[model samples]
Structures are given as structure tokens and as C-alpha cells.
Target: MPISSTRSSASRIPLLDILKGLACALIVGHHLVFYGPMSDVAYPLAPDLMDWLFAYGRMAVQVFLVLGGYLAASTLAPQGVARFDSPLQQVLRRFVRLSTPYLAALMFNLLAAELARYGMDDGSVPAEPSLPQLLAHVFLLQDLLGFEALSAGVWYVAIDFQLFVLAVAVLSLARFLSVRWKAPWLAPVLVLLGACASLFYFNLMPELDTWGVYFAGAYGMGMLAFWAGHSTRPYRWLVALATLGLATLALDFRGRIAVALVTALALGVLQASGGARHWSPMPALQRLGQMSYSVFLVHFPVCLLVNALFNQFWPTQPWANAAGMVIALALSLRAGQWLYQHVETRLVSMPMALRMQGGLLVATGLVLLGLKAL
Candidate 1:
């Protein structure tokens, strides 16, 4: 059999973007149903379909976490130590890339909420925000520290940020151990062992204030997939074993099966598609994939705004509610894609001096985790 090849390293592992986009869309639908008319302060009307979509919509976030782990692991490994840039620089880059858009979304949500109240109150002028905790919101620590999220969709960003830091450490350790052991495979093996330890720790002990273990495993798996894809003969056996494990996880054995299954499947996707691109003649999905972050961030506020506006006007039209939701989702995705291309893409490439900033972030995260334990 002829193995597939690609010009771009990213093209070799194509499923991730698709999965991420799917997750974001599911989240949008989920939030629409979740915070629709059922919410206490919801507008007087929302679509009846909200109840139906709620359950299915809830699965998107977890899927995203699993996907995050797989990608983090695959993307962070050094091409060569001699050509290796500092890991800290990479970490800082990730932080800024994720944070800038998140902050923008937060601001938009804040402004939208204020304007919403004004219009709802018959134009008497909106009340000021009592949720001043928006101050801590940008750091992605609010959710873990027991504060409500500053924006509706920010909890996942918090999760991603936490996972990113853990991933850096995990990859760094893998690199260090590889050098000490004098074997290339040693690093990957240690990473696998570490993943198992994390899975066990998170499942049984569960004492850490943060859920970094699971995230670490997932992101590390992604990195592994990336490596396997580049190899002449990838680890086909591991993929098979992971697939079986995933099937068992789907059976619900109450043994962190879901995590194992999700982790496995995520890696499997990367492994199988490692050499191939799921190309399409039509580019709609590629566009969606590109705008995924924006879609994920902006969807919540759109839903919230739609809910408020719909209730004020319709008061009880379920069909109209659904129609409005569809429209808002479409418009939100388009806007998100536009912003991502114009604003986020450029910001993502901004130079950060890697040595100090990335190292400090990794140390800070570890210190924070240790403090949580103590």
C-alpha cells in the first residue's frame, strides 16, 4: 500500500480542525437550548426545540477537551534540539494566541449585557455590571477558583489554558528523559506512562484543584499522533489497542472508560489520518474550521442576546425562536471567521521572547498546582 504524503505538516493530521469545529457548533446549540427560555431571566419566549437539543449539545465541551489533549501533545514536540526554540516561548505564544480573542469576547459580552438590560427596561438606561469579577476573568482562573465565568463561553478557555501549561511540562519532561536514557523511543514511552499515571490519579485520587492530568494525557496523545504520522511505519498496534479500549469505554464500565475511550479515539483519528487530508471540492468546512475559535467564543453571547430580544418581542413563539436562533448562529459564525482572519491570525504570530516568559508560565502553573495540593 502506498502511504499518503503531504507538503504541509498540518495537512498530515487533518481531522483535528474538523473535530474542533464540530465541537464548537455543538456547544453553540447546547447553549442555545440551555440558556434559552428555561433560564430565569430569559426573554418571555424561546423555541420549544431548546429542550430537545440540550442533551446532545452538552457533549461538545468534553469532546473538545479530548481533542485538545491530542493536539497539544502532537504539536509541541521539538523538530530537533539544535533547531529547537525555547518551550517557554511557545507557551507564551499559546497564552497570547488564546487570550487575546477571549478578552475580546469578554468585552463584547459585557457590553451586550449592559445594552440588553437598557433595551429591556424600556430604554431607561442600563444598570451597571455588578459582576466586577471580570477583572480576574481574562486570566482563565475564575472558573477553577469558584467564581462564575466572566463570559458565558469562557470556561472551556480556562480548561484549554490549564491543559496547555500541563502539556508543555509533559513534553519538556519527555524531552529531558529521552536525553538521559539515550533512546528516542524513551521519551514517547515515558509520556505514555505519565498519561496512565495521570488517568489513574484523576480517576481515583481526584484531589488536585485543577484537572490537568486528563488534559495532559489528551494533549500528549495528540503530540504522539503527530509524531506517528511523520514516521515511515507508524505505531499501528497502539492505534488498534486504543480503538478497542475506546469501544469498551463507550460501554460505560465506570472506570474512567470515557476518558480512556475519548483519549484513544482522538489519537486514533490523528494516527489514521496522519498521512492523509480529508480534502473537499467545496471549502465550506475548511472555512468553518478556520473560524472555529471565534464561533465557539461568540456563540454564547449571541444566544444570550437572542434570548433576551426574542422574549421581549415574540413572548411565546417557539418556531420564531428557533428561526432566530438559526439566524444568530449563522451570523455569529460569519462574524467570527471574519475577526479570526483579520485580527486573531496576526496576533497569533506576534513574537514573544521564549526563554523567560514561557519558563515563568510553566513554573507558575506547577507552583499553583503544588499549592493547591498543599
Candidate 2:
């Protein structure tokens, strides 16, 4: 079944937006204060009060991952009036919707980096990325090959993109399996597979980093929620299971188990909130959700620029760092609004075909590659 692009007519839940907004702000706060204080240039302690703040701050990224997966699945999965298209079409639509904003952001960040480099007098030449790496960024293939990260916060985008692909695959497989086998147990099996995968990645592949496995579980959980969202029955067992999962998270169980817990929590939230149909009225919260993506993308650069300026001019006062972060966040939020309104808004809704977007991506990659050779 094909999911419709047309948004549901239910009154949009402002709380979702608020959650997104706060989540984005948390990410900015994490990058600005948490990582900074941990680095040698900032804080010396790792697990003390400062360290604890950073640790908790980092969880904001995790929140975004969980929320994003939930939202993506909610929007993309087959639903009312959503025409069922081939898997290829599903994949293409995802690509187009995701990649366009990414491309715009990448270009903007690169240009900003270039400007920063030009203004610095430290005699440190910024290392120019290889053309291949640049192309990879444009194509959202950097993570697939373990290449360089593109934007400051783009690693999540890469994860999201990959999971989106997997979602399509999983949905198709689930549909096929349901037809051939028992239909009632398909969701449970998927939930089980996700649990297994999370454990395998968390325990066995500790070197793979928390971002990948964490987001994958979140995305899978989102898919689960999507499938169950339309159900009319009370899912008492599901609620109990999700509660157990969240307990694992609160207990500091990292990796697959933890990811599962977070995913479950997200599903629980959506369920409690009425599955996007009857979420409580929280206009401010809704605004946050709407700006969450912008917050995610814009914060890193803002912080980086602020740090650079601080390093160049003002002596490192903790007060200055605090002020810089506050200022950067305000500017970033304001800029995000403008960009979202003028650029992303227009581009997202344009009668743009995925094929053309693909071609432009290829051309952009080639151009970057040629620049590397120069």
C-alpha cells in the first residue's frame, strides 16, 4: 500500500513540535557545553559534575534519533489514501525528500567553513577534503563507507537515510511474509529481530559507535508504532513490554538493549499521545517539533563559529563560552526560520522529480571531484 503525502487532517499536535524544538536545543547545548568541557582546551575532568552534564546532554541526540524515526515512519509508511507504489518509488521519494535539504545544508556549511578559513590568521590552512569525500557527502554515502562526516550534525542524517532504506526493505518483506505465513506474529518477529540486531551491534561491535545501532533501533521501533497506530484495541501487553524496555535504558544499559528501550518509549509516547490524531494541545511544543530539524543542522556551525571567534579574540572565560553559546543558538534559530521559510519550504514543495534530483547530485559530485584534481 502507498502512503499519501497529504498530511492527515487531524489537528496537529503542538506538543510534538515542542518536543522537537527542545530536542534540538538540547543537542545544541550538548555540543556547545558537554563536548567543549570534555576536550583538553575546555574542561579537564571527565566524570565529575561537568562530565555528567555532557553525558546527559549527549542523550539529546538519542532523543532526536528516536523522535525522527517515529515521525518518518508515521509519514512514510502506508496509510489512508496513500497509493501503494513499487518499492523503487517508495525509496525514491524518501531520497528526494531527505537529500534536498541535506544538499542545501552541505553547500551552506562548506561555504561557511571557507569563509572562516579565509578570516583566520593563525597560518593554519584548513585541510581541503578530497573530491571523493565531498561527493560522498552529497550522496549521503559517507557513513555507508565510513568516510568523513559532512555537516556538524549530519551523521544522524546519514543514519536516518540508511534506516529509511531499510524501512522500505523491511516493510516490503513484512508484507510478503504476511501473505506467505502467519500474519498475526509478523510485528513481534520484527520487534524481536530488532532486539537481536541491537544486542549484536552493541555488545559485539563496540567499536561501531553508539550512533548507528541506536538510531537503527529507534527507526525500527518507529515502524512498529506505525503498524500499530491504527489499531483500535488496547495493547496492554505492549505497554508492559515497553515499560520494561525503558527501565533498561534508565539503568544505563547501553547498546541494543538500551536502544530497544528508547524505541519502546517513543512508541509509548505516540500511543499515549493518540498516534498523531489526538495529541494534547501544546502549540509551543508543536513549534519545537517543526524547528527540530533546523535546530539539529544549524547548531553545530553556530557553535563552531562561536568557538573560533572566541579562540581568536576573547580570552576563554567560562562566562564568554556561556554567552557565545546563547548568542549562537539565538542566531541559529532565527536563521533556521528564515531558511526554512524561504529555501526549504519552496524546495520541498516544488514539482521536483527524484530523477532530476539524482542527476543534480551526480553533477554536484562530479564538480567536487574535479575541484579536488585542480
Candidate 3:
């Protein structure tokens, strides 16, 4: 659901961006098919294809998870040492940066939901949000608090935040332990052990899905990829990564984990082979990748609106609905482009980000009040 960029263009990896673009496209398609009436109407045309997408499209999220980890490691601790002065400050900054655009997207989603309610009586349109629900989303605690997500894939945002915080904490702990033990290798070793624990234990528990530890293995694989890419013994690191992932699957096979492991390993291989550094940028793909976060944030609202239109005016016509799906996708990209340019790319200050969050809460109140009156 996310990514970061701190490196200069000259230092950036083209392949990662290209992969992100592809993964973002898959996630968008997954939601388009999984959520609403468009896919339902078009199902008979391609039952197998629709089913396949419904079942596996979400695996793209693992790609994002690995990518997020890779980028986070490159920025947070490229050399496996904590670079920031304060973990709290770094975490808070990440929260602010994430929520600034997120809150705006939520506003669009809330409005779209209301509009969708009038157009279709389907389950895809979210129910009117309560105060606690709105607040949960504002604080990125919706999943932990057991609130129904107001939009598709928002859980990933909360999970992304949790993963980042977890990463920061682990790195800080590793730094402390390294100093205390007088062993520089402890940082990477501790991280590796933690990732193994997550894969072997925490990741297997469905009840812990809302927490960072549940997804730490995939993210850790990404972090390890960074270290491996830079290490002289890249093959050893790659073998260790593959062994851990494969062993986890041997115990309990999860296709998502497989995707994550493959993504991480591929990234490690690319980084090790210098492909990551020398790859030529595909302009279209890289652009899509750069704005993929915005695409992820805004696509739901665009999808809702398109689905509503088709449901209200053109119910159950296969070709029309399929084409509407295409239109929705195109509109989603356009909306994402607008959002990336207008709201997401802007450098929001702490004070302004706070105000935006406040605005989100206030807007949600107004919408709920309107719903009640109606």
C-alpha cells in the first residue's frame, strides 16, 4: 500500500519502481473485481479468470510489503545501524506524512460511499461511519480497534504503519544490544532472528493479522535484501533468505508468503548483480510507480463512483459492465494522478497535517449528521 523515496534520482533503482507500478495495477484490478457489481455482471464471460483474480490478485500486496521493507531498510539503516537520532520522531514523521494524503483520500471515500448508497444497495458501499469508526481511521487504528474499514485495502495502510514502527523499534533494540554486547554483527543477526520468529510463529496466527509481527518476516526479508546486496557474501545471504522462506512454507504453506519471498529474493538478486543500479527506467512504469501510493489511496473512491453509475443505469449488461470497469480503472488512474500532484506530493508540515486530520474528523461528522437527517 506504500513506499518511500529519499535517494537521489541517480541512485534510485528503476526496477523497483517498475515492479511497484505492476503491483499497484494488480491491486487495483483485484479490488475492482472483488468489491462490487461490475465483476458480478461480467462473471459468466470469464468465470475462471474472475475467480483466479478474486483469489490471487491480493497477493500483489506481498510485493508492496517486500518493496516497502526494501526501501525502509535503505533509508532507515542501510548499514544495519540506526541512523536517526530518535525513533519516536521518525515514527511520528512517518505517521504525519502518511496520514496527510490518507485523510484526504478518506474524505473522498466517505463522499463516494454516500453517493454509492443512493445508486446501489449493494454491500460494497460502506455503512455510515460512527464517531469511533471515523476516529479509528484518523489515528490509523481502525484494524486494531475492530472497525469496519470505510474503504477497500485501508487495512494495508494501518499494517504498513505498524510494520514501520516495528522496524524502527527493532533497529533501535538491535543498536542497543550491539553496543552493550560489543558485537557489531548483532544488529543484522537480531533482525534475522526476529524475522525467522515471525515466519515460524507470529505469521501463522491469523488472530495477530492486525499487528506488525505477523508480517515482519516479509518486511525483514526486504531489509535483509539490502544488507545482502551490499555484502561480499551475497550468495550466503540469498541462500539463508530462501531457506527461511521455504522452511516456513514447509510448515504452513501460504501463497502470499511465497510471493513475498520471491519478491525479496528477486530484489536481492537484482541488487547483488548490479541490475538494480544499471537498469534503464521505463518512463511510463516508473511514473506509475512513483505515484502508486496516490493510486492506491484514491482508486477506491473512483471505483465506487463508477460502480454506482453502472449499477444504477446499466445493471447486468456484461459488455457494458466490463467496459465500465475499464472506464473505472482509467478514471482511477486520472484521479490518482490528480491526487498525487495536488495533495500527496505536497510537502505538508506537522501543523498542517494535524489540521488536515482534524478536517477529516470534522467532515466525517458533517456527513454522518447529514445521513442521520436524511
Candidate 4:
């Protein structure tokens, strides 16, 4: 049976925005506790809470991976077949969308780190970046190349890109086969089987965690949920997808997989019931979700700055540290709003943007090299 296409709409989904807002908050809290000395001071007061946030807050990223797949499917190939003229072009477009804001954030963080260094000594300050390291980051290969990250959570940016490219490639290949053999089911079936293989086999191997295949299981679950929610027999497809996901988990239990499965299922149910479209309007949550990517990109530097200020001024007051955390969160949101407005929403031609990014990368690398020599 052919999967149904999602109804086209310009309005953003409230449920999705709410979820993204929540995820961004969790990630911000996680970093607040994990990266800075503020957490150390507060740990004596709320040790258990601090520990929990430090440990599990990072898992919130699974929500993003799942949501990304769902939205990618909704936008790129709603009927479970590639619609673009070239998958490469689609990938390039996504790369530009992600990279522009990312490069701006990186430069901002670099400046923040330098300023923080003059204020006090702290672990939150990243080491001065080398030319090679900057180049690796420009290409989104820092983690894979074993170079130290200049900022927290930047690895996810690279991983997001990888997962997107992989998804497009898989769907594009399936589309090619379907066209060649004149079998519509062939595309969906092949894609589904590939997802299963990812869940059962590739996800089981930890060594591949840096690559998209490692997270393809979770990402694929999102893709499947999108199709299932829009399918003619929505319940049947949802149950089938859930059963497959559960079976994979049963074979090799993973905490992350459990989280991903639940997230995907929740998204599927929401989409199927029209709940995604009809949720009570929340302007605050909607705004947060709209700027979630910008928030994710810029929050770390804001946190780092707050941590430095707190350490230099208060040093030992728990209340001061707590207050700093609140201030950091507020500033992060404001910064995100500004970034989204100025950098993310601004229109630039793809070729021009790519060229600008490439030029900036070379200039930054040269400056880093000159600094190393000095």
C-alpha cells in the first residue's frame, strides 16, 4: 500500500514547537551543570538534581534526531519517494541552512571564550583553536578527526548533517529503483528494510556511533512515524512500526533506543490525530521552538560567559551561582532571537553563502596559524 502524503500547511505544528522548546531547555540546563564551576558550587545544595541533570539531560538530543527525521520526511518526501531533482542538491541546501548559522555561532563563541579568559581561570574556556582544528570544524569533521571541539554540542551539528545526507541518499536510491522497475512498493519496502537493518545491526555497534548509521535507527524511526501517521491505515502502520522498534530493542536493549522509540511514537500519534495541528496556541513555546536551532548554537557561549562572571565575582555563594544560571538562560534566549532574526532568516543565495563560508574558513585558518607562530 502506498503511504499517504502529509497535508501541506504553512502553519507550524504546536506540539513540535513545544517539544523543541523543552528539548532546548533541557540541553541548556545540562550544559549549565556539566561545563562550568557554577554547578560545582550548587552541587552541595542540590547534589542529586545536579547529578541527574548532568547525566541524563544530554539524552534530550534524541528528541531532536527523531524530530529532524519526521520533519525531513514531511518536507522532502511526504509520499515516501524522493521528489527533488537531485538528492545532492537537497543535501547541499540543508548544509547551507545549517552551516550559515553554525559558522556565525562558532565565531561568536570564539570571541566569548577569549573574553572569558581575561576574567578568570575556568574549565569552561576552550583551548585556543589551532588552524587544523578550525579547518576540521569548518568541514564539520572535528569529532571524526579526533580534534577537540571549540564549543559544546557542536558535534551534533555535524551529526545532523550526516544523518540528513544519508536519509536523502537512501530515499533517492529507492526512488531510482522504483522508476527503473515500475514498482511503487519497492521504494518504501527497501527504505523500511534499511531502517530495520540500522536498528537491529548498525545501532548495536558502538564504534560507528560517530556516523549517521549509528543513529539511523532513531532517525529512521522518525521517518517511519511520519509515513505511518499519514498512511491510509494510520493505526496499522503505527502498530507495525512500533512492533518493529520494540522487537529491535528486545534483541539488544539500549536506553537511548527506548527514548527514541517513545519520542517517535509520540510524534506519530500526534500527527495522526491532527493534534499536531490543533494544539492550544502557545506563543512562548512557539517562539522558543522557532529559535530552537539558534538557541542550541549560541547557548554554550552565553553559559561560558556567565560562568566566568560568577566565578570572578561571587566565587562561593550558592545563591549567586543559581542566579547566574537564570541570567544565562535569559541571555541565551535573547541571543538566539537576535541570531535567528539577523543571521538565520536573512536571505542569501546558496552559491554566495557557500563562497562566503569557504572564504571565512580560509581567513580564520590563516589567522589561527599566524597566532600559533606568534
Candidate 5:
């Protein structure tokens, strides 16, 4: 859900990285318990902990969505004005950057799922992908086109792309309106209105989840937090951000939205207090945060692999399955580190991204076709 190419090494915000890291860990833990024979076997040992992780751990995504918006704002529209001349170029670049690492990770996931299926017959093992399903995923359209995701959290990748396009379009139009009327308020006002609309209307409809508007509330809040954080009147902007979120909750409560609101607000406060820059984070947290997107993308396949191993060898050993959860987490972090270094850190172009995605599709299709033949 995040690969912030916004700030450079020197300008990186520790707070953002720390939060993203913590959120990434929760997301991984949540899935370890969720997509598991491991967690199923170990559940009786710590039902309350397992229950809580399953129930609320996924909400950590709200943190990523919010942080993604915040970073997007910093990169795309720091001044609440459109910086890019061509919105298409901005979006295309973002797509390329996102998809490069994404397709690489998808390739790993596809192989991992196949390996897991070979090992165990759990329902969580994604079935062999059809051609159309693979094509939709290549374009980050699996969720939009109603294909079963090849892996968990794939929908978020599509939604992230969609939300970025929406933000660019909205802010580009705001720039046009701002110049035409000479009103600075047009940009933030439009963004705020979109956020309000989502929080009040679109977000309530489960059907709209595939689109950006459904999650625009949190994303917009993050955008606004950027503007507000750098504003002359930071507290005033903070108040407005808080007020909008509170109003939404007062009217119709949603725990996910509540987490988003809190995350945005926490970021705002940190930025306002200069803690975003000055706070020294532990090395581990910062490293994890820096590679949070990598972890987010790759953790699922690792979890599935570990779960399959447990299913095959230690299916009835509760303690062993519990240890498998830890093993999965360690392996996930290692896999993410490798992905970050090998793929995410590369200077990939549009062509390269397309080639990787094409390779992913062809390779994954071959695996599926081979299985069918057998």
C-alpha cells in the first residue's frame, strides 16, 4: 500500500517511517493468524490474542492508506497546488514505480502459492489463475474487474493506484479553478469536499470499495494533513481535520475510518510539533518502515508457505504451529528485505515495469498450464 518515492534519504520523515513499519508488522501478524492452519492449531493456546489480531489487525491498513495519502500529498501537491504540468505523466510515472516492484512480488507470490498448493490442500491456497485473471492483475484491475485476487491485499494495490489518480485529477482541476478565480481556497476546499463526500456517503456503500472514492476520506485527510502541516496556521488546519473526522464518526461510526482519522491526526500533530523531523527512531523501526511497502506486498506468500509447511508436517502440534507463526514473520521480513533491495530500489522505467509484469503473467501461466496437463 505504500512505496513513498517522495522524500529523499536526507529529507525522510522518521515518524512516517516508524508508523508505516508498525502498521506493516500488524498487517503481517494479522494475516499470519488469518490465512493459516498455523493459527488454527495455535488458537486454543491464546484465543484472546488470536481473536484480537484477526478482528482488528487488518484495520492497520487504514494506517497505510492514510500514510500513503500523506506521502502522495507531499510529492504531488505539497502546496495545495498542482505542481505537474501533465497529470497523465504524473500518474504514469507513479504507475510504473508501483507496478515494477508489485509485479516482481506478484511473481514470487504466484510461485509460492503453487508450492503451497503442492504441499497442502487448504482453502487459502489460491487456485491456478485463468488467463483473464492474470491479465487483470497485470493491470492492477483484479478487484475492479471482479476477479479473485491471486493473493491477499492485492486489491489495495489497485485501490492505491486509483486513489493516486483521483488525487491528481482533483488537485489539477483545483489548480485550474484556483488560477481562474484567483482563490487559493479552491484546492483544499475541493479536496475537503471530496473527503466529506466519502466519509458521509460513498464510504458507507460496500459496492464502491473497488473505487477510490470509497476510501477517499482517509486519503484526502492525509493530503490535507500535508497542506496543514506546512501551513502558517497549523493548529487551525489540524482543528479542521479533526472536526471533519469527528463529524463523520458522530453521524455514522466506522472503526476503520476511526483509525484513519487518528492516524492522520497523529501525523498532523507530529508534523506541527516538528517531531516528524526531530524524533529519532530506532534503527529497526526505521528500516522496517522504509521497506514497509515491500513487506506489505510480499508477506502473504511467505505466510501461505509457512502455513502449508505446518499443515503438512505439524498439523496437530499446537506449539509447533505457534512457532511456525514466528518463523513466518522472520521469513517475511527477510523476503521483504530482499525484494526491497533487488526490485524496489532499482530505477525501473515504464518499459521495464511492463516487461516484468509480462514476465510474471507468462511465467505464472506456464505453471498453471503445466499443472493442468498433469
Candidate 6:
């Protein structure tokens, strides 16, 4: 099968974009309350609202996991069998695409943290990065290595990359088997079984949470959803996917898993019924969706800056703290736009080898500077 011909060139799915935008906004709000001192000031005014946002808002990441799986399947194996040349090359390409902007954002975050340090002492201020810690983060192993994260939500980046590589491997295995067995449904069945194991077994183990396997259930659901949506027997596959997801949740009830299942089902139905077209024409939300990754990368530092400033200037003013949250949100969006254009777009266009060299150069420079400062 010719690669491009089997690939799905489905029009940009507006529904998915909308969901991404909404999830990004929730994540930003979650960080603002979870990280900043400003939330302390605003909490008394709206305790219930603040508590909810602080507690459950981070679950928005489930949305991204589902979407990532959907998009990965759509690109790599639209018919549920990998057609790419080399999984290693695919992994390298994805690493570059994710890490280039990630490194650039870390630099900005370090600068912001330094500047914020001069303003106030609060939990929001991350400790100064050591040379080793910086290196760990550069390799996206800070969490696994037990180093404190330089920025909030960075764990997701590492996990996202891991999930992509794992998915590619599974798809590649299916492709290999397809050469021997000419059954068109063999690949999808194998992938679904893997997903079931993830959901019912791996996901139940909290110790595996740092690894992609813990979250593979949800990510795999997204992959299954994508294939199911596009299948010739769309209704049959969609029903099967939903039933499996629900059964897994019933076996081991997790609120987050429930949320993931719902998100996956919604995305599957939207794609199946062509509801991914212009159902809701919110341009701003669509733009947010486009920049969601950038927003995720940079929002923590932006929130830190605002929190430091608010504590310094209006420590007792509750309303000022509320205003600062709004300012932080706006600035995060603006910063995301700047980062996407100057950092993400440029690096994504470069060859993988060049991008890796550039990232290493930047990381080495930052680490050396941090060591010197210490």
C-alpha cells in the first residue's frame, strides 16, 4: 500500500481543536491556583470555586492524551498498521518537534524564575537549577530521576514522547505480523488487546504512573477511537470501543480514567459523524487549540511572574490578586504566540540532526551558566 494513499487527509477537525483549547485554558487556570500565592488571596473570596479548580483542573491533560493518540494514529497508521519507514526515525522526529520548543521555553522559564526570585519568597519560586538537574530536564528524565521539575506540567511532555514511541512500536509490530497473516482486522485486534492490558492491568498500578504504560489505556483509547471512527463499520467499531472502555473503568474505577473515556468517546463520535467539521465556529478557541502546546510549555513561568509581582505590590488586596490572574492568562497567550512563531516554527522546520545539535548547544550553555552562577 502506498503510504500517502492509505493516510487520512481528513480536514482539520474543528471539534478537536475546540476541546484542546478548552482543556488548555483549564490547565492554565489549574496552574495559576496550584502554583501562585495569588490564589491564596483569591481563595477566601471564592473558596469553593478555587478549591475545585485546584483539585480537578489538571485532569484536563486527559484531553491532550486522547487527542495525541488520535492524531498519531491518523498520521502514522490510519488503517491501524504502521507504514512509516523506521520507528527510530519517527521517534527522533517527534523528539525534535517536542524538545526544540521545550528547550527554548525552559530557557525563558529559568530567566523568569531568576527575575521572580527578586520579588518574593513563595512556594511558586522553584529552587535554582543545579547543573545535573538541568541536564536531567534537558533529557526529559527529571521526574524519573527524582529531580524537582524546573516548570509545572513538564512531566506531560516526557510522557507524551514515551507514549508516541510506544504506539509506534505497537503499530510496527502489527505491520510485521500483517505480512504473514493477510487479515485486515488483525492489526486493530492486536492493538486493542494491548490497550486492554494497559487499562485493566498497567493503569491499576500507581508506581507505573511515571511511565507511558500507566496512561497508555487512555492514549490507546484515542487511537482506537480514531480507527473506529474511520472504519467501514463505524457504528460497530465505535460501540466496541466504548464498551471496552466502560468495562475497564468498571473493573477499576478511577475518576481520571472515566474522564478519559468520556473524552475519547466524544472524539470518536465527532470524527465518525463528520461532526469534526465547523460545528462550533469559535475562531479564538481554534487559535488557542493551535497554540495549546506552546501555552502548556510557557504558562507556568508566566504565572510565576505575575504571582511574584502581585505579592510585592498588593499583598493584601484580594481584588488585585484576581486582576493579576487575568493578566497572567493574557500574557500566557501572548507568550505562547511569540514562542510558537520564533522558537517552535523555526526548529520544527529544521532537519532532525541540526535540531538535536541546536538543542544540545542551548542546554549545555544554560547548564554551564547555572553552574557559574552558583
TM-score of model 3 relative to the true fold? 0.94
TM-score of 4: 0.93
* Model 1 lDDT per residue over 108-204, tens place: 6655555456335422222333444554565677756667664566766877887777666656776676678765555556556665565445534
lDDT of each: 0.58, 0.57, 0.86, 0.84, 0.86, 0.84
Candidates 2 and 5 compared: the better one by lDDT is 5
lDDT against true structure, model 6: 0.84
Residue 262 error, candidate 3, Å: 0.6
Question: How many clashes would you count in candidate 2?
Answer: 15
- Estimate TM-scores for all models: 0.75, 0.76, 0.94, 0.93, 0.94, 0.92
Question: Positional deviation of 294 in candidate 2, in angstroms?
Answer: 2.1
lDDT of 2 by residue, 1-374 (tens): 12222433234445556666766776666666643221324453333644655666566665666665556555554242222458787777666666666666665565445545543433222245677887787667776667767566677777777776666666667667776785734543564476457643553455665245645655555554444443443255456457645654565566545644554555545654555555557766566568667656665555556556766665446565556556777877876776566545554432564554566556655665665566
Which ranges of candidate 2 are over 4 A from the true structure? 1-12, 34-50, 76-83, 118-126, 182-188, 200-204, 210-214, 226-229, 243-252, 255-263, 266-282, 347-374
Off by over 4 Å in 4: 5-12, 355-374
lDDT of 1 at 260: 39
Put down candidate 3 lDDT per residue, 105-167, tens digits, no spaces.
998899889888888888889998887998899889999999999999889899999999988
List pairs with backbone clashes in candidate 3.
none
Question: What is the total number of backbone clashes in candidate 3?
Answer: 0
Q: What is the lDDT of residue 304 in candidate 6?
A: 88
Clashes per model (N, Cα, C within 3 A): 11, 15, 0, 0, 0, 0
Instruction: Please list the Cα RMSD from the true structure of every candidate, rounded to 1 decimal place.
Output: 8.7, 5.6, 3.6, 2.5, 3.6, 3.0
What C-alpha root-mean-square deviation, in Å, does candidate 2 show against the real structure? 5.6
